[model samples]
Target: MSIIIITGGSRGIGASAAKQCAAKGMGIILTYNSHPAGAESVVRQINAVGGKAVALALDVTKVRSFAAFRDDVAKALKSTWGKDHIDGLVNNAGYGNFNAIEAVSEAEFDGLLNVHLKGPFFLTQALLPLMAAGGHIINMTSATTRVATPGAAPYAAFKGGLEVLTRYMAKEFGPRKIRANAISPGAIRTDMTSKAFDQSPEFVTLLAGQTALGKIGEADDVGRVIASLLSEDNGWVNAQTIEVGGGYNI
Candidate 1:
């Protein structure tokens, strides 16, 4: 079975992707930092349906912890699937921040930078040794990179960086046959974005109005795309940024 590691797999797009990947017969090692309960719940959901999944704790911002996290991943692979290698890594762990460029503070910028770009860079570096030849790497980015969302400057900037990094990863790892790609979703109803909706109720309707599909995206909408990207069927599709939005801002 293909063994995959999905970061931030406790909820939102991460959790949805974990379950979807499991549904397709992949062994999942999902990571959660603050939401153990949510992670366990997802494991149970997968197990109840006869799918195999395991949850581990990971704080993506702490580059120091990545070496240890890779070790834990090694242990999980050995123990759970009796495998010594990972087939794929989904760098999906992230949060949302909303502030215009002029008003954005340094802490906010650094926080977004740490989690969205720096964390994924070092984490991928740390895990590359354990990743098998032909392994896939999927970086979760944001469509805000293209849409120029007013309050998402820092977050969008880092996601844009990650998209660029994905291409580089594909170029560099091509010799190893490890493919890398970015999935850029627009206006998904995730925990990170919902927090903003709590403060501004019209945020949802406004986004929906802007979308060609006439609705905000659900977690599973993007999840299915992510799971499909990790599958062997997409092996030839590399160094691409697939926008999974329902035609948002277009």
Candidate 2:
């Protein structure tokens, strides 16, 4: 069976992607940050349905821990699936912050850059050796890069950087037959957006109206797409930014 490693798989899009990937008969190595219980629950759900999954702790912001994280991944691969390499890596671990460019502080900007851009860059570099030939890399980007959103300057900027990095990864890794792509989600109904949805009806309405589907996206929607991208069926697709936003902002 093909094995996949997903970062930030404790909740939101990452969690949904783990379950969905498991359902399709892939072994999952999911990472969680500050949500071990949530990660355990996701593993339980997958196991209850006869799917195999293992959760590990990973703080994407801490680049110093990546070597240890790689060792842990090696151990998990050996014990869980009796393997030495993973078939895919999903850089899906991230958080969102709302602050305009003028109001954004340095700490806030650095935090976003660490998690959204620097984290993915070094994490990929650390794990690149473990990714076998034909492996795929999926970077989670945001539709905010395409359509400017107020109060998300830093977050969007880094996501946009990740999108560019995805293309570069594809170009550089092509010789190894390892494909890379970016998935830009639009207004998904995840915990990341819960505060806005719960606190501002007008903001929610505005988001819904921007979507051609007349509803906010769900985690599973983007999760399924990510899972599909990792499948062999999409082997020919690489170096592309796919916006899974229900025709958002069109």
Q: For this target, which candidate reaches the highest lDDT against the unseen true structure?
A: 2
Candidate 2 TM-score, true structure as reference: 0.99
Per-residue lDDT of 1 in model 2: 92
- C-alpha lDDT of residue 157 in model 2: 93
Worst 10 residues of 2 by lDDT: 187-196
Question: Which number leads on TM-score?
Answer: 2
- Model 1 regions more than 4 Å off: none
Q: Residue 3 of model 1: what lDDT? A: 94
Model 1 C-alpha lDDT per residue in residues 127-164, reported as the tens digit of each score: 99999999999999999999998888899999999999
Clashes of each: 0, 0
- lDDT of model number 1: 0.94
